[model samples]
Target: MILALDVHYKDDGSAKSVGVLFNLKDSQPKEILVAYLEETDEYIPGEFYKRELLCLLKIVEKVSMHDLEAIVIDGYVYIDNEKRFGLGGYLWQTLNEQIPIIGVAKNFYHGNNETVKQIYRGKSKKPLYISSVGLELDTASDFITQMPGEFRIPHLLKQLDTITKEK
Candidate 1:
Protein backbone atom coordinates (compact mmCIF):
# COMPACT_ATOMS: atom_id res chain seq x y z
CA MET A 1 0.00 0.00 0.00
CA ILE A 2 1.06 3.56 -0.71
CA LEU A 3 0.06 6.41 1.57
CA ALA A 4 -0.20 9.96 0.30
CA LEU A 5 -0.05 12.62 3.03
CA ASP A 6 -0.93 16.31 3.06
CA VAL A 7 -1.85 18.98 5.63
CA HIS A 8 -3.85 22.20 5.56
CA TYR A 9 -3.24 24.90 8.15
CA LYS A 10 -5.87 27.09 9.72
CA ASP A 11 -5.80 30.81 9.00
CA ASP A 12 -4.67 31.58 12.53
CA GLY A 13 -2.01 28.91 12.37
CA SER A 14 -3.28 27.49 15.63
CA ALA A 15 -4.34 24.18 14.16
CA LYS A 16 -4.16 22.03 11.03
CA SER A 17 -6.16 19.45 9.12
CA VAL A 18 -4.29 16.40 7.84
CA GLY A 19 -5.30 13.83 5.23
CA VAL A 20 -3.90 10.43 4.38
CA LEU A 21 -4.95 8.52 1.26
CA PHE A 22 -4.16 4.86 1.01
CA ASN A 23 -3.98 3.12 -2.35
CA LEU A 24 -2.75 -0.07 -3.93
CA LYS A 25 -0.40 0.54 -6.86
CA ASP A 26 -1.49 3.30 -9.31
CA SER A 27 -5.16 3.12 -8.45
CA GLN A 28 -7.54 5.43 -6.60
CA PRO A 29 -7.38 5.52 -2.85
CA LYS A 30 -9.17 2.67 -1.13
CA GLU A 31 -9.21 4.57 2.16
CA ILE A 32 -8.90 8.13 3.28
CA LEU A 33 -8.09 9.20 6.86
CA VAL A 34 -8.34 12.65 8.32
CA ALA A 35 -7.05 14.15 11.56
CA TYR A 36 -6.97 17.50 13.31
CA LEU A 37 -4.04 18.67 15.39
CA GLU A 38 -3.30 21.79 17.38
CA GLU A 39 -0.16 23.46 16.18
CA THR A 40 2.51 23.07 18.83
CA ASP A 41 5.26 25.04 17.19
CA GLU A 42 5.41 28.15 15.07
CA TYR A 43 6.36 27.71 11.42
CA ILE A 44 9.99 28.66 11.26
CA PRO A 45 11.26 30.01 7.91
CA GLY A 46 13.38 27.01 6.88
CA GLU A 47 12.17 24.34 9.28
CA PHE A 48 8.63 23.55 8.10
CA TYR A 49 8.82 19.90 9.12
CA LYS A 50 8.74 20.86 12.79
CA ARG A 51 5.18 22.13 12.45
CA GLU A 52 3.70 19.65 9.90
CA LEU A 53 5.50 16.45 10.87
CA LEU A 54 3.43 15.99 14.02
CA CYS A 55 0.20 16.24 12.07
CA LEU A 56 1.39 13.65 9.54
CA LEU A 57 2.58 11.32 12.29
CA LYS A 58 -0.80 11.59 13.98
CA ILE A 59 -2.62 10.44 10.85
CA VAL A 60 -0.06 7.75 10.09
CA GLU A 61 -0.59 6.13 13.49
CA LYS A 62 -4.17 5.32 12.44
CA VAL A 63 -3.00 2.99 9.67
CA SER A 64 -1.14 -0.31 9.77
CA MET A 65 2.56 0.30 9.56
CA HIS A 66 3.29 -3.20 8.34
CA ASP A 67 1.10 -2.70 5.27
CA LEU A 68 2.69 0.51 4.16
CA GLU A 69 5.03 0.02 1.21
CA ALA A 70 5.85 3.68 0.82
CA ILE A 71 4.76 7.18 1.80
CA VAL A 72 4.21 10.07 -0.60
CA ILE A 73 4.64 13.54 0.82
CA ASP A 74 3.93 16.96 -0.73
CA GLY A 75 7.43 18.29 -0.39
CA TYR A 76 11.07 17.52 -0.85
CA VAL A 77 12.95 14.73 0.88
CA TYR A 78 16.23 16.61 0.85
CA ILE A 79 16.60 20.30 1.70
CA ASP A 80 19.82 20.85 -0.28
CA ASN A 81 22.59 19.40 -2.39
CA GLU A 82 24.17 18.22 0.83
CA LYS A 83 21.15 15.90 1.40
CA ARG A 84 19.76 17.68 4.46
CA PHE A 85 16.45 16.24 5.65
CA GLY A 86 13.16 17.84 4.69
CA LEU A 87 9.63 17.09 5.91
CA GLY A 88 9.51 13.75 4.07
CA GLY A 89 13.02 12.97 5.29
CA TYR A 90 12.00 13.54 8.88
CA LEU A 91 9.03 11.21 8.39
CA TRP A 92 11.32 8.56 6.87
CA GLN A 93 13.66 8.75 9.85
CA THR A 94 10.72 8.68 12.26
CA LEU A 95 9.64 5.44 10.62
CA ASN A 96 13.21 4.16 11.22
CA GLU A 97 13.81 4.20 7.44
CA GLN A 98 11.80 1.04 6.99
CA ILE A 99 9.28 2.40 4.49
CA PRO A 100 10.29 4.22 1.35
CA ILE A 101 9.21 7.86 1.01
CA ILE A 102 8.57 9.76 -2.20
CA GLY A 103 8.37 13.53 -2.10
CA VAL A 104 6.37 15.22 -4.83
CA ALA A 105 6.42 18.99 -5.04
CA LYS A 106 4.73 21.31 -7.52
CA ASN A 107 7.50 23.85 -7.41
CA PHE A 108 11.23 23.43 -7.55
CA TYR A 109 12.84 23.67 -4.15
CA HIS A 110 15.74 26.10 -4.26
CA GLY A 111 17.91 23.84 -2.13
CA ASN A 112 17.47 20.55 -3.97
CA ASN A 113 20.14 18.90 -6.08
CA GLU A 114 20.39 16.60 -9.11
CA THR A 115 18.88 13.80 -7.10
CA VAL A 116 15.51 15.48 -7.57
CA LYS A 117 13.64 14.29 -10.70
CA GLN A 118 11.33 16.45 -12.77
CA ILE A 119 8.32 14.82 -14.45
CA TYR A 120 5.84 16.48 -16.77
CA ARG A 121 2.27 15.32 -16.88
CA GLY A 122 -0.42 16.03 -19.47
CA LYS A 123 0.36 19.14 -21.51
CA SER A 124 1.83 21.19 -18.68
CA LYS A 125 5.18 22.70 -19.56
CA LYS A 126 6.07 22.79 -15.88
CA PRO A 127 7.09 19.60 -14.15
CA LEU A 128 6.60 18.14 -10.73
CA TYR A 129 9.68 17.93 -8.57
CA ILE A 130 10.28 14.52 -7.08
CA SER A 131 12.73 13.25 -4.46
CA SER A 132 12.87 10.05 -2.50
CA VAL A 133 14.29 8.15 0.45
CA GLY A 134 14.80 4.33 0.46
CA LEU A 135 13.76 4.11 -3.23
CA GLU A 136 15.70 4.93 -6.34
CA LEU A 137 14.95 8.37 -7.81
CA ASP A 138 14.11 6.91 -11.23
CA THR A 139 11.72 4.41 -9.76
CA ALA A 140 9.96 7.07 -7.71
CA SER A 141 9.65 9.33 -10.74
CA ASP A 142 8.25 6.52 -12.86
CA PHE A 143 5.63 5.72 -10.27
CA ILE A 144 4.49 9.31 -10.04
CA THR A 145 4.49 9.68 -13.78
CA GLN A 146 2.24 6.68 -14.16
CA MET A 147 -0.18 7.66 -11.39
CA PRO A 148 -3.83 7.83 -12.49
CA GLY A 149 -4.25 11.41 -13.57
CA GLU A 150 -4.44 13.52 -16.73
CA PHE A 151 -3.57 16.83 -15.13
CA ARG A 152 -0.55 18.36 -13.46
CA ILE A 153 -1.19 16.63 -10.16
CA PRO A 154 -2.28 13.05 -9.59
CA HIS A 155 -5.98 12.50 -8.84
CA LEU A 156 -5.39 10.91 -5.43
CA LEU A 157 -3.01 13.67 -4.43
CA LYS A 158 -5.57 16.27 -5.47
CA GLN A 159 -8.18 14.43 -3.45
CA LEU A 160 -5.86 14.45 -0.46
CA ASP A 161 -5.50 18.25 -0.68
CA THR A 162 -9.24 18.66 -0.98
CA ILE A 163 -9.93 16.43 2.01
CA THR A 164 -7.32 18.19 4.09
CA LYS A 165 -9.06 21.52 3.47
CA GLU A 166 -12.45 20.18 4.51
CA LYS A 167 -13.84 21.47 7.81
Candidate 2:
Protein backbone atom coordinates (compact mmCIF):
# COMPACT_ATOMS: atom_id res chain seq x y z
CA MET A 1 0.00 0.00 0.00
CA ILE A 2 1.01 3.55 -0.67
CA LEU A 3 0.35 6.09 2.06
CA ALA A 4 0.00 9.84 1.79
CA LEU A 5 0.32 11.93 4.95
CA ASP A 6 -0.38 15.51 6.05
CA VAL A 7 -0.53 17.37 9.34
CA HIS A 8 -2.44 20.41 10.56
CA TYR A 9 -1.77 22.39 13.69
CA LYS A 10 -4.35 24.15 15.84
CA ASP A 11 -3.96 27.43 17.68
CA ASP A 12 -3.94 25.55 20.98
CA GLY A 13 -0.66 23.85 20.06
CA SER A 14 -2.38 20.57 19.30
CA ALA A 15 -1.95 18.76 15.99
CA LYS A 16 -3.79 16.26 13.82
CA SER A 17 -2.27 14.01 11.23
CA VAL A 18 -4.12 12.13 8.51
CA GLY A 19 -2.95 9.30 6.33
CA VAL A 20 -4.59 7.98 3.17
CA LEU A 21 -3.74 4.47 2.12
CA PHE A 22 -4.25 3.35 -1.47
CA ASN A 23 -2.76 1.63 -4.46
CA LEU A 24 -0.95 3.64 -7.09
CA LYS A 25 -3.73 3.41 -9.66
CA ASP A 26 -6.63 3.93 -7.27
CA SER A 27 -8.54 7.16 -7.42
CA GLN A 28 -9.82 6.81 -3.87
CA PRO A 29 -8.35 5.87 -0.53
CA LYS A 30 -8.61 2.31 0.78
CA GLU A 31 -8.20 3.41 4.34
CA ILE A 32 -7.97 6.74 6.12
CA LEU A 33 -6.07 6.87 9.42
CA VAL A 34 -5.67 9.74 11.82
CA ALA A 35 -3.52 10.61 14.85
CA TYR A 36 -3.68 13.48 17.23
CA LEU A 37 -1.32 15.09 19.70
CA GLU A 38 -2.17 17.20 22.69
CA GLU A 39 0.88 19.36 22.20
CA THR A 40 3.48 19.56 19.47
CA ASP A 41 6.85 21.11 18.89
CA GLU A 42 6.74 24.72 17.80
CA TYR A 43 7.46 25.26 14.14
CA ILE A 44 11.09 26.26 13.65
CA PRO A 45 12.08 27.60 10.29
CA GLY A 46 14.86 25.58 8.58
CA GLU A 47 14.06 22.78 11.02
CA PHE A 48 10.47 21.99 10.09
CA TYR A 49 10.95 18.27 10.47
CA LYS A 50 11.18 18.76 14.22
CA ARG A 51 7.65 20.11 14.42
CA GLU A 52 5.91 17.68 12.05
CA LEU A 53 7.91 14.46 12.23
CA LEU A 54 6.36 13.36 15.50
CA CYS A 55 2.89 13.83 14.11
CA LEU A 56 3.73 11.65 11.14
CA LEU A 57 5.33 9.04 13.37
CA LYS A 58 2.23 8.80 15.47
CA ILE A 59 0.05 8.07 12.45
CA VAL A 60 2.59 5.75 10.88
CA GLU A 61 2.57 3.50 13.93
CA LYS A 62 -1.08 2.74 13.19
CA VAL A 63 -0.06 0.86 10.07
CA SER A 64 2.38 -1.98 9.43
CA MET A 65 5.67 -1.03 7.85
CA HIS A 66 5.90 -4.31 5.93
CA ASP A 67 2.73 -3.44 4.06
CA LEU A 68 3.86 0.01 3.08
CA GLU A 69 5.26 0.36 -0.43
CA ALA A 70 6.05 4.01 -0.04
CA ILE A 71 5.02 7.06 1.96
CA VAL A 72 4.13 10.40 0.42
CA ILE A 73 4.59 13.53 2.50
CA ASP A 74 3.46 17.09 1.82
CA GLY A 75 7.04 18.36 1.96
CA TYR A 76 10.48 17.52 0.72
CA VAL A 77 12.75 14.53 1.09
CA TYR A 78 15.81 16.59 0.29
CA ILE A 79 15.60 20.32 0.75
CA ASP A 80 18.54 21.23 -1.43
CA ASN A 81 20.93 20.08 -4.13
CA GLU A 82 23.37 19.11 -1.38
CA LYS A 83 20.75 16.56 -0.22
CA ARG A 84 19.76 17.95 3.14
CA PHE A 85 17.07 16.03 4.98
CA GLY A 86 13.54 17.39 5.13
CA LEU A 87 10.45 16.10 6.94
CA GLY A 88 10.08 13.16 4.57
CA GLY A 89 13.78 12.49 4.79
CA TYR A 90 13.63 12.29 8.58
CA LEU A 91 10.68 9.90 8.31
CA TRP A 92 12.58 7.72 5.87
CA GLN A 93 15.49 7.56 8.27
CA THR A 94 13.28 6.92 11.28
CA LEU A 95 11.87 3.91 9.43
CA ASN A 96 15.47 2.72 9.00
CA GLU A 97 15.09 3.34 5.30
CA GLN A 98 12.92 0.27 4.90
CA ILE A 99 10.20 2.05 2.95
CA PRO A 100 10.55 4.62 0.23
CA ILE A 101 9.40 8.20 0.73
CA ILE A 102 8.16 10.62 -1.89
CA GLY A 103 7.92 14.31 -1.11
CA VAL A 104 5.46 16.44 -3.00
CA ALA A 105 5.83 20.12 -2.31
CA LYS A 106 3.61 22.77 -3.88
CA ASN A 107 6.33 25.38 -3.60
CA PHE A 108 9.86 25.06 -4.88
CA TYR A 109 12.78 24.94 -2.47
CA HIS A 110 15.53 27.10 -3.83
CA GLY A 111 18.66 25.16 -4.97
CA ASN A 112 16.61 21.96 -5.20
CA ASN A 113 16.10 21.95 -8.93
CA GLU A 114 18.91 19.45 -9.43
CA THR A 115 17.35 16.91 -7.07
CA VAL A 116 13.64 17.53 -7.53
CA LYS A 117 11.52 17.21 -10.63
CA GLN A 118 8.90 19.84 -11.40
CA ILE A 119 5.72 18.12 -12.59
CA TYR A 120 2.73 19.97 -14.00
CA ARG A 121 -0.72 18.47 -13.54
CA GLY A 122 -4.17 19.28 -14.88
CA LYS A 123 -4.44 22.88 -16.03
CA SER A 124 -2.19 24.25 -13.32
CA LYS A 125 0.69 26.28 -14.66
CA LYS A 126 2.65 25.76 -11.45
CA PRO A 127 4.40 22.45 -10.95
CA LEU A 128 4.49 20.13 -7.99
CA TYR A 129 8.06 19.78 -6.73
CA ILE A 130 8.86 16.08 -6.31
CA SER A 131 11.67 14.54 -4.28
CA SER A 132 12.35 11.14 -2.79
CA VAL A 133 14.53 8.75 -0.84
CA GLY A 134 14.94 4.96 -1.33
CA LEU A 135 13.71 5.30 -4.94
CA GLU A 136 15.09 6.76 -8.12
CA LEU A 137 14.20 10.42 -8.60
CA ASP A 138 12.57 9.81 -11.98
CA THR A 139 10.57 6.85 -10.69
CA ALA A 140 9.26 8.93 -7.81
CA SER A 141 8.32 11.77 -10.15
CA ASP A 142 6.50 9.35 -12.44
CA PHE A 143 4.44 7.98 -9.58
CA ILE A 144 3.26 11.46 -8.58
CA THR A 145 2.58 12.28 -12.21
CA GLN A 146 0.37 9.23 -12.51
CA MET A 147 -1.62 9.95 -9.34
CA PRO A 148 -5.31 10.58 -10.12
CA GLY A 149 -6.33 14.20 -10.00
CA GLU A 150 -7.95 16.90 -12.06
CA PHE A 151 -5.92 19.57 -10.29
CA ARG A 152 -2.39 20.23 -9.13
CA ILE A 153 -2.69 18.10 -6.01
CA PRO A 154 -3.68 14.46 -6.36
CA HIS A 155 -7.17 13.56 -5.13
CA LEU A 156 -6.03 11.51 -2.15
CA LEU A 157 -3.40 14.04 -1.10
CA LYS A 158 -5.91 16.87 -1.24
CA GLN A 159 -8.31 14.71 0.72
CA LEU A 160 -5.65 14.13 3.38
CA ASP A 161 -5.08 17.87 3.72
CA THR A 162 -8.78 18.42 4.28
CA ILE A 163 -9.02 15.56 6.74
CA THR A 164 -6.06 16.78 8.73
CA LYS A 165 -7.51 20.25 9.12
CA GLU A 166 -10.91 19.12 10.41
CA LYS A 167 -11.75 20.31 13.89
Off by over 4 Å in 2: none
Total backbone collisions for each predicted model: 0, 0
Looking at candidate 1, the ten consecutive residues that score lowest on lDDT are 17-26
Worst 10 residues of 2 by lDDT: 108-117
Estimate, for each residue in 1-167, the C-alpha lDDT of model 2 and write its tens digit.
99999999999999998999999989889999988899998888899899999999998999999899999999999988899998888999999999999999999888888889999999999999999999998999999999998999988888888888888
Compared with the true structure, model 1 gives a TM-score of 0.93
Candidate 1 CA-lDDT value? 0.85
122-158, model 1: which lDDT tens digit per residue?
Answer: 8889999999999999999999988888898988888
In model 2, the clashing pairs are none
Note each model's CA RMSD in angstroms: 1.5, 0.8
